[model samples]
Target chain A: MTDTLTCANLSKSYGGVVAVRDVGFTIAPGEAYGLLGPNGAGKTTTISMLVGLLKPDTGTVVVGGADLSADPMAAKAKIGYVPQEIALYPDLTGRENLRFFCRLFGLPRKAVRARVEEVLDLVGLADRADAKLDTYSGGMKRRINIGAALLHRPELLILDEPTVGVDPQSRKSILDGLERLVADGMALLYTSHYMEEVERVCDRIAIVDHGSIVAEGTRHELVALVGGADRIELTLDGDVDTALAKLRGLGGVTEAVRTAAGSVRLIAEGGRYLLPSVISTVDGIAAVTAVEVVEPDLEATFLHLTGNTLRD
Target chain B: MRPHPVLALVAANLRRHSRDRVGLFFIVVMPFVSIIFVGMALGGGAAAARLPVGVVAQESDPVAAAVLAELRAHPDLEIKTVGGEEELRAGVRGGALAAGVVIPPGSTRFELVMTQSSGSGMAARSAVDASVGRVAGVIEATRAATSAGASPAHAAELVRRAQAASADVEVVGSDTASATPRGFAYTAPANLLLFTFINSMAVAAALVESRRIGMLPRAFTAPVRRGAVLFGEALSRFLVAAAQAVLIMVVSSLLFGVSWGEPFGVAAVVGVFALVATGAAILMGSLVRSSAQPSAIGPPLGIVLGMLGGCLWPAEAAGPTLDTIGHLFPHAWGMDALLTLSRPGTGLGDVLLEVAVLGLMAAVLLSLSLVLFSRRTRTL
Candidate 1:
């Protein structure tokens, strides 16, 4: 089967600044792909170019066998995009907003009513579909926003940070709904800075930074990049910078950096055995208040590759 | 089987407008209310009362005195004496007097001076002319009697007896037809043009709001082309302007007894002017950076343009320079077309030039606005 989306060498720049540089990816049908990056890491710019909102300085995109530059309408028709912002109309009820998108997408008039109903049920907003969007919670509005994208039943769905600013319960509902969509044979390209979400929903994940994809693989394959290294997080009581410096010089500690939360995180081989020496190395500079020797994961993989935590 | 995206957009805009009570009040209710108030302020739609007329007699000529007395005796005329002809002319020109009559020295005929552009001035002229014409007839009959060798005293007695006999016999005549409609009829069309344009321009805020909320970008993500989106926005504005025009026309006609002349002529004017308004609205939406900017500026700008275009008063009455300047706005052409239709025996053929000019204005404005709006939408 043909890939649902195939983009290669995507790059964009604004004036003198480069936003995305030589980025490329492809997603098979029914597969979930995640582009993980922190804020201002060029995820949105890449998405914008992919959706044809902006012309890439140099690149190409193909959706369901249609070249985006040659046949935008056909390419766009095969893709569904849910932007990070809640883009639904506030004055309109949920049903009205969905019906409007259906008309815009040129769905058959006879099928619009049934399709709108189905999408509302899929998003789990059928009971409150008649309520205007202004009356909905942030999470509910985000669900409606997602529902709008699904009305046309595009072959691939692209969501940019879908769970940002949403309540936990509603976020869970959105994730559950998305999981069902992926299971039912819809390709997904999800972008977010949240590590757990990407790990939970994406079949394969790509760690993006500085407008380029630095690493790409499945969960186990990505963790293997860390090479049997364990992640050790240390909470220091005093002089975190000095402790970070000393920890970086330790024999077993390959990587050590101060986190945004005033803690030192280090990656080392056999971190469980190195814990005693790790505490002794920082003993004079700062007292070790807490320590956790975590096994290799995507976060450790991101840190291992980018030399910076995903939260950075 | 699906509706075109342009029509879908138009439908959605109209639905949003319908839900906004404040917007409905401005677009639907305010025009008629303004018509009633402005019509009443201009002394229209009320019972006819006594009109003030100034009289100037250069000499104490008995014939002139008799004419003045006859004018005063007429129930519809309230006569005021002026010291000289200049003062009488000034009074009529200044609108203190509806009309003025000057009886020159050693002349039997009287001069009637009034501003022809004023409806009341024209009415006063008719009343004064009737009184003067009656006196002139008596004078002519007396002179003929003298020419036949009758004594002056006998001629005077004969004229007095003739006047006494005619005093008890009253002849009522229907009022003369005018090209312009008075009272609510005049205000209805004027306010219709004013409010429709203003309301259309104000709806630019909606476009800006859509952009701010990311709705425009979301729409662009659909399978539709940029041209379809721009056309959809323009079509929605046109529909709104057309709806406002129709509502004002229907309500004014039914409630206030306003007779809009020649159906096809009125439609041509309203339809073209609606397009012009849509163009202006689209241009404003494209140029403004924020929703508040259009809301703050649109109404005041519309009012100024309306005033210049004769929505507040007759442009002709404002003199030649202003009348020439008024045509620069589409509202003036619309007003000219509507007023032409109000005249008896006039049809679409008679106001073709005005309609053509308005159509041209609409074309230029729509073309320019569509180009700007297309460029702006791409950035959004």
Candidate 2:
């Protein structure tokens, strides 16, 4: 059996506010899954429950096929968590910090020494492992934070906002590290609000919103759910509904949304094949000034499903 | 068993603690140095005190000069000359002379008169009394032996028999008196107090730092139980605190020559006090977030507790009110136990109440801290 993590009907609410409601998903072994969402979505809440950092108000969390809440130690043994906040001890040297976590996972002394060296190399902190974290730059601290979790080499790794608030170079390095972890046959449940990150790294993506998974599947599969491979956006001079109505009448136009500023955006299946048709079809509207045909992006898929920008 | 995750944390914490030179200095060195400094400040030996005194001689007898010379030889007494009885009385009242010695005219006797309630006055008058009493007895024995028809050598022998008495002091208290600690004996108890307090601050900082760094959160995510974390933390703190207590006992006795009374009893008291401080650090760490909060809060609290519990000074000097108030601090109970243990000649049984109370307090505080700490980790 694949060592996968599953959350079954996990629901949590604070008073009258539901944070994660009836959320269910599973990450296959060695499969890198992204829990993508906008701000205020249930991504973090679900990650919190899945990692056993929180007990869901209703339902159960299972890691590596073992119930998390049922036998936490057993469930936790198979999982490593890299929290959103940088969690490395600032007072300790990188080597010392890794050794500290290695013991926490019960690795033998010899194994601990080996693992510390390995993790330091993995995180690109091998040369700087002797330096105290307070002396490290923000990027170095983030890498050390990730290294602490990687020391034990658990079956599953959970990273909450894995690349939050880092320089672009560090963020790329972190993503590269995550990809390598997956290649090393480690399953990952990565949560982030960054659309490009999810698209670039995850094999499967689940869009979470308002405490539920509104849409989820592989990137191509999910974009295919919208039934159109391309989305065309038209900026209308003053009146957008007139142009949107004309665009909707054209063949290959699957859906059309008119934004508040008179920009009409059309999500169409087989967008590339229908781009010329869309341009010629909307040419009669005369209100259309600019047209752009975009490929199936997480942003468009997200907007198609949630009616809001991925950032929003 | 997967080598208890908390034990690993304990080792790391201890390592970090040792790395903190400033904290280690405060924990291990400050108490040791404070003992030496405070001992020097208090007078390291049972040397006599110099008291300001007034002497009123109504008669210009040459015997009075002889008495003054005898008084000068006693290391503890410093006698001063006064103009008249009125001047002596005024000097004593105005706080210049601790007491006044009046030698009445047409009489062979002398009188000691001053506020007996003052420590300085008591010390002064006691010194004067011993010297005068020695001189008077010898003279009286001489007259009596001569009257009884003894030879000059025989009279001197009688005087020797009469005058050979050990020096003694009669002390009394008043408002403006400088309080003497039941003297030289406050060292052992005070050292116990100071060591416990400094170690507690260091432990508190360690605990808070662990929480802030997310080490505690990471530990909880592993196969480690929260109880293990709490116990591990306590163990680390106790290790440091126990070492601190041993240093205090050794230093106090070696340098101050402070008799720590029953050796085993002193060890037991120190051990229990360390536990109490460990629990307090855990509690403070759980109740706050970040190292700054604990570092900021621990030392000040330790200092306040030290003062209230009579670590820097004796709780005895604080009297009934402050003494009762001092019991609110765990250090007070520990100090009281130490004081009983070091009271020149006190057995373990003599401090049972204090020991039991301190033990109970340590148990309760440790339980509360464990409960709080476990709650914090249980979330993750």
Task: Using DockQ, give the best candidate's number.
Answer: 1
Off by over 4 Å in 1: A15-17, A220-249, A255-267, A282-312, B46-181, B317-325
Q: Can you write out model 1's per-residue Cα lDDT over B316-341, one digit (the tens) per residue?
A: 56677887888899888888888778
Per-residue lDDT over A1-312 for candidate 1, one digit per residue giving the tens place of the 0 to 100 score: 899999999998889699899999999999999998766678888888888788899999999999999999999999899988888878889999999999999999999999999998898899999998999989889999999999999999999888999988998999999999999999999987778999999999988888999889998888887786898988888888878888888998888988756688898999999999998988888888888999988887876677653444
Candidate 2 second chain TM: 0.68
DockQ score of the complex predicted as candidate 2? 0.42
**Against the unseen true structure, what C-alpha lDDT does each candidate score?**
0.85, 0.76
Docking class of 1: acceptable
For each of the candidates, what fraction of the native contacts does it recover?
0.67, 0.64
RMSD of each: 7.2, 7.3
- Model 1: colliding residue pairs: none
